[model samples]
Target: MPAIPPRFSVTPEEIDRVVATFYASVREHPGLGPVFAAHVKDWPAHEVKIAAFWRNAILYERGYDGNPMAVHQEAGNVRPGMFDPWLGLFDSVLRHELAPETAAQWSALAHRIGRGLRYGLVEAATLPGGIPKLV
Candidate 1:
């Protein structure tokens, strides 16, 4: 099992800050910017959704409801190779904005999510008839 943070706690404010900075970085990213810009029409609304996603993920707040896999698959713009830079940016933001331990904890979660998303994308791409539709 992974070691839990004994002295650190994730808060809503921290989640919000991290999400804001991380997405801002993504918005400026050369490869990712156009991809995100093509999809999200409302930046503020997207920010709230992702911030809630991180809060619910790290804090178990159960505030997020959207299906990430479906969303990514539907994005069509997110290729399999893009996860690395996305995770890198996320880790960089966490490391810069939070305590080391807290950042690691958050980064670990991001890594897990990134891996899953990438795996799903890869599998979908390899399917015989293209990605299957989610019910």
Candidate 2:
């Protein structure tokens, strides 16, 4: 049996470059920087982990092993509203770091994932009986 190939025409090195560049922007983003800063003390380690996650997601690699939804829920500070700015920043970085076609592909994937994460955060924060809290 042959192994599955990567979904997109991007290399591991490209993934690393994009991840590094995106997170550097993230660290300086007014809306996102503080949120990430509160949790990620080691930027380099976080970038490596996130790059592994993208590799797993896009390249069919088995290097990442973590639940993003669970981690966000556990953080208790990740808001649903943050997804927009986060995705916007991510799209910009993708556009700047990769070829236009590759950037579009990655952006589409990221937006889909972001929507799931945003929905999860919203559901996690809602009150019982399908009601959202007023707070």
All models, RMSD in angstroms: 5.0, 1.2
lDDT of each candidate versus the true structure: 0.85, 0.92
Q: What is the lDDT, from 0 to 100, of the residue 88 in candidate 2? A: 93
Instruction: Candidate 1: list runs displaced more than 4 Å.
Output: 1-8, 128-135
Best by TM-score: 2
All candidates' TM-scores? 0.87, 0.95
Error of 2 at 33 (Å): 0.3
Q: Tell me which residue pairs clash in candidate 1.
A: none
lDDT of 2 by residue, 1-135 (tens): 898988899999999999999998998998899999999999999999999999999998999999999999899788999999999999998989999999999999999999999999888879989788666
Residues 1-135, candidate 1, lDDT per residue (tens digit)? Answer: 764442348788888888889889989999989999999999889999998887677666667899999999999878879999888888899999999999998788789889999989878777466655453
Q: What's the CA error at residue 59 for candidate 2, in Å?
A: 0.3
